[model samples]
Target: MSIEVGSKLQGKVTGITNFGAFVELPGGSTGLVHISEVADNYVKDINEFLTVGDEVEVKVLNVESDGKIGLSIRKAKEAPPQEREQRRPQKRSPRNQGNNRREQLSFEDKMNRFLKDSEERLASLKRNTESKRGGRNTKRG
Candidate 1:
C-alpha cells in the first residue's frame, strides 16, 4: 500500500539509529521516523523506545519527491485522559490564599502601591543620573 501524508499504518522497525528509526510499511516500502517525531517526551536514546523487529503504529508526516517518507509515532497515539482533564477549566477558591489573612486590597490601595513603586523607581533613576553627573562635574572642577 502506498503511504501518503496524514495516513496511519502499522510498520515493523527494520533499523534504528541515533537520529531515527526505519520502518517497513505495508507495501514493503521503508520510511524514516525522525528522532523528534518518536514521542511526546524527550527521547535520549531511540533504542529505549523502539527495537529492531518491533511493531509500531506510525503516521506518515511527509513524502518527499526523492521517495523519502517521514513518519511520526507520537501523532499516532492518543493523548491520555488526565492530560485532557488538566487542560479543562478548573474551579478556584474565592478566598485569598496567603500567610497574611488580610482582606484583598481595594482599588485605591492598588493605585497607591503602583504610585509608590513608580516613585521609588524614578527616585532610583534620578540618584543614578545625579551620581554620574556628580562624577563628571567633579572631574571638570
Candidate 2:
C-alpha cells in the first residue's frame, strides 16, 4: 500500500530511542514518530507513552524522497477545537508582560537604571578579577 501524507495508518511500535519511537506501518514500512509528536505535552521519555509491540494509529506527516516517513500519533487522534485551544498556552495580559517597561519609563529613568546596573556589574567583575590575580595589593615583578 502507498503511504500518503496526511493519511492515518495503523502501526506497531518496533523500537524506542531517546529521541523518538520507530513504528512499523502497513506494507512492512517503518516510520519515526518524534518525541514531540508523541503527545501534546512535554515528553521527557518516549517510553512513558509507547512501548514495543503496542498498536497505535498515526498520521503520516511527510514522506521524504529519501524514503524517510515522518509520523505523528497525536495528530492521528482528533480532538475538538475547544480542547485544542485549552491545550495551547494562553497569552499573558499586558500588565504581566514586562516588555512595555521601557515605554512606561522616561528616558532619564532608563539611563539612570542602566548606569546603576552597569556600575554594579563593573564593580563585581573588578572584584572577581582582583581576587583571581592574587589580590589588589600584590605587586608583579
Candidate 3:
C-alpha cells in the first residue's frame, strides 16, 4: 500500500537503533520513527519501547523526496491525556491559619517585627554592597 502524509497504518518493526526504529509497512515499504516520536514521555532508550518484529501503529509525518518516510508512533495511537496529580500540596499561609489569626498582636509587637525585618534587610544589603566593593576589611591605606 502506498503511504502518504497523515496516513496511519500498522507495521512490523524491522530494526531498532539508538536514534530510531525502522518499520516495514504493508507492501514491503519501510519507514523510520525517531526515538523522540516513539512516545509522549522521555525515551532514553528506544529498545524499551519497541523491538524487532513488534507490530506498532504509526502515523506518516512526511514523505521525503528521496523516498524516506518519517513516522510517529506517539501520534498514531495518541493516548488520552491522563490526569496528573499535583506534586506539591496547596500550602496554607501561617498568618491565616489557626491561633495566629485569632490572636491580635499589639501595635508595639507589629512595630518590633517590622523593625527587625528592616534591620535584617539593611544589614544584608550593606554586606552585599561591601563585598562587591573589595569586602568589609579591605580599606586600602
Candidate 4:
C-alpha cells in the first residue's frame, strides 16, 4: 500500500540507531521514526523506547521527494482531551510569568522598566563590592 501523509500505519521495527528507528512498513517500504518523534517526553536513547521486531503504530509525517519517509510514533497515539490539558502549563505567578508581561508592554515602557531594574541592580552590586573592600574609604594610618 502507498504511504500517505497523516496516515497511521502499523509497522515493525527493522533497525534501531542512535538518531532514529527504521520501521518496515507495508509493501516493504521502510521509514525512519526520529528519536524526537519517539515519545512526548525527551528520549535520550532510542533503544530505551523501541527495539527490533517491535510493532509500533506510526503516523506518516512526510514523504520526501528522494523517497525518504518521516514518521512519528507519538503523533499516532491520540491522547485524551483531559490528559492533553494536564500536560499544558498552568497559570504562572507574577514573578515567574515569562514574556507575557513584557509582550503586553509598549517598547518604551519595557525599556524604562528594564533600565530602572538594571540601575537598581547595579547600585546594589556596587554597594556589595564597596562593602567587601576593607577600609577602602576610611581614614587609614
lDDT for model 2 comes to: 0.94
In order of listing, the candidates' clash counts read: 0, 0, 0, 0
Give the residue spans of candidate 2 off by over 4 A: 80-141
How far in Å is the alpha carbon of 52 misplaced in model 4? 0.5
Q: What lDDT is obtained when candidate 4 is compared to the true structure?
A: 0.92
Candidate numbers, best lDDT first, in rank order: 2, 4, 3, 1
Q: Each candidate: RMSD to true structure?
A: 9.5, 7.7, 12.4, 7.6
**lDDT by candidate, in order shown:** 0.89, 0.94, 0.89, 0.92
Q: What tens digits encode model 2's per-residue C-alpha lDDT throughout 1-141?
A: 999999999999999999899999999999999999999999998888999999999999999999999999999997878998999879868776887566799889989999999999999999889877889666777
Q: Write the per-residue lDDT of candidate 1 for residues 1-141, one digit (tens) a residue.
A: 667898899999999999999999998899999999999999999999999999999999999999999999999885668997998768545643552343477779879989999999998998788778784434554
- Please tell me which model should have the higher lDDT, number 1 or number 2: 2
> Which 10 successive residues of model 4 have the least lDDT summed?
132-141
lDDT of 2 at 13: 97
TM-score of 3: 0.56
**What lDDT is reached at residue 127 by model 2?**
87
lDDT, residue 126, model 2: 90
Model 4 deviation from the true structure expressed as Cα RMSD, one decimal place: 7.6
TM-score of each: 0.58, 0.58, 0.56, 0.59
**Local accuracy of candidate 3 as per-residue lDDT tens digits, 1-141:** 788899899999999999999999988999999999999999999989998999999999999999999999999886435523344346767765786653588889889989999999999998888877988566777
